[model samples]
Target: MTETRKQLLQELAAKNGTPLFVVDHEVLRNNFKEFREKLPDVQPYFAVKANSNPEIIKTMFDLGSSFDVASIYEFKLIYKNIETWPDKERQDFIWDKIIYANTIKPFKVLTKLNPYKILVTFDNIEELKKIKQRAPDVGLILRIRVPNTGSMVELSSKFGAHPGEAVDLIAEAIGMGLDVEGISFHVGSQCNNFDNYLQGLNFTHSILKEVALRNFEIGFTDKEGKKKKVLDIGGGFPVKYTPDVKSFSALAKKLNLEIKRLFGKDNIQVIAEPGRFMVATACTLVTKIIGKSIRDGKTCYYLDDGVYHTFSGQVYDHQHYPLHAFKDGELKLCATFGPTCDAFDTISLADELPEDLQIDDLLYAENIGAYTLASATDFNGFPVAKVAHINRENI
Candidate 1:
């Protein structure tokens, strides 16, 4: 926590809105710089799908961060904002090169899109043919095995090509004159082990090395084996959402070295599409205590923000939110709950908190900027969470 976070929490409590998404721009900037420094030459592509707050995206831009977006709407968001820049001196916004990470892309979307703007991914052979038929001139990186191996945060569904299928897909795409540039995968979200990156990158290298033997000689179509263009290993860089999250700086350092070691340091540019690390700690959810109780030797605090709207209920990782004890001052044990009528709208199931909790008292839950907002919806007419950008940097 920084001085800005402390002051902002105090202010957010007084500010109107029960369930609010308050972002700390300064905190976000620090995280952004950390990614830039650690990855060195890697294009730190901020995943907008994780936390699509334009304000935070602007903060990233100020810190010289590139982005990794999914949909055309997301890519359009970048274009919408880019209009504000001085056209006389154009800035190189990476939106032009945002990866279209959706494993199953539609032919309609591909045909309508300017080919160079999207780095399309395909899992099935039909999808690759669709890309070929619709936009054959485009560059693509086959999304390899949907990792049952990555972070257990959001269960990455089996959406990409199977282990042995990636090379085949690449070969077919090249036969269609499509540029099969590289490969990518997700180890997990909120990934605890930085070595997971090395594992993923090394795995991608192994796969690419195999693709090199495809006999679809680039610069000479009849020849076999060719040098690859890029290796884009998708991101799951962890942020300190809770005390339990182990920092893998040593692991990350080793992974960086390994990436340079295996990928020849200069010819390949690694792309880290970090979502949570970019925006998690940068924002906090300010939810008010709506009700409270005790059962089976445990305390429960029902909050205005529920799992339906926050998705914290479905989160099994037990994300430790830096719960604040204010209004009634001092601290004691209390479990947090959500406002939803569902019996499972529990936020803090057995978490200890200040016994001073009272109705209307505020709890600033740190690291709420990522999946919560992106996955939020109105259940039982519950309104969308009000969002606000707050930080010492902004002040």
Candidate 2:
């Protein structure tokens, strides 16, 4: 941990008080650089689902990350406050850059925004039929939703077709003359086992091969560093919020090797929609020691950060982020909870808190950028955490 980051968070806490989030802009840029350095062959479209803050998005855009919109709402959010919002400029806006509307079942509002360069994902022939009727002018990228090899905590058993059927779906789309540009897949979020990643890339490459064999005009290569005229890997380069989760960079290398072996070369222009990894560690939420308790011989630090407002789906995903006390001395076991009403809004296990904690004490958690703010709600009518941006200069 950079001393400056620690001090900045402390300073932000001092400046904004409890229930606040501080984002390190430099960490985000470094993350993008590291991922690109490792997979320099592929272009990264910053998955905005992780952090929708205009500041963070502007930082990412300034770092040269492309846009990967999963929904129209996310697209709006990305451009809402940014100076480069596409149509707001009002001139042949669809030609600006590649913005993929990567979600299934887009509404008419979504189609109305800009369907020219907007890529839609078709899971089945039904959605295919709907796209033809709903948004006739749009090109489509089929989202090949692969199931959890039971390797991930949650399964996307709800989305996409089996690998065997994905080929036929792509073929059907081609037969319909739907503007099929490229293919995509989601290696289950928070995946630990590397084999799960290998399987997803294999599936996508297979479909791409089928598309190639069909003599489709789809691009398989661009002048390296140029726009990928090929396939995309959605569902991110996985980041380990938990200490025990596998390394995302290692998995990327492994998948890159598999991709080379399959293609006999690494020329495919790949687009990765990485949300969790890029931003998960770029931000941390800080709260005041509004309250504390001693229960079952353990110190419970109840900060003002609401669990629903901070980490809504974290526990359900079995993420074990590092917990730390403010004083930063000897670590001890203690329970940590939020100031929510249900009494179930705890962010950590009962064993994570320190032993010497006291009333009005401060604490911090790490690897908290991804789902922390996006899922926040005013449920208990609690005011959400305030935010502060940190730059590399400070670090």
lDDT of 1 by residue, 1-395 (tens): 56666676668657757688787788888887777777676777788888787777777766766677778777666556566766532322432336777777666778865434456666788887787778776567767664445364644566656767667777777777777767777767777766556666766776667766656532211113434355666777777655676774655677777887887743454676788887877777878888877777666787888777765525644455656654444465667766767877666565557775778877776667777878777876888688877664541
lDDT of each: 0.68, 0.68
In TM-score terms, candidate 1 sits at 0.85
Using TM-score, give the best candidate's number: 2
Q: How far is candidate 1 from the true structure (C-alpha RMSD, Å)?
A: 4.3
How accurate locally is residue 293 in candidate 2, as Cα lDDT from 0 to 100?
74
Weakest lDDT window of 10 consecutive positions for candidate 2: 88-97
What TM-score, computed on C-alpha atoms, does each candidate reach?
0.85, 0.87
- Badly placed stretches (over 4 Å) of model 1 are 1-4, 83-96, 146-150, 154-157, 215-228, 293-299, 311-322, 327-332, 392-395
Backbone clash count, each prediction separately: 11, 1
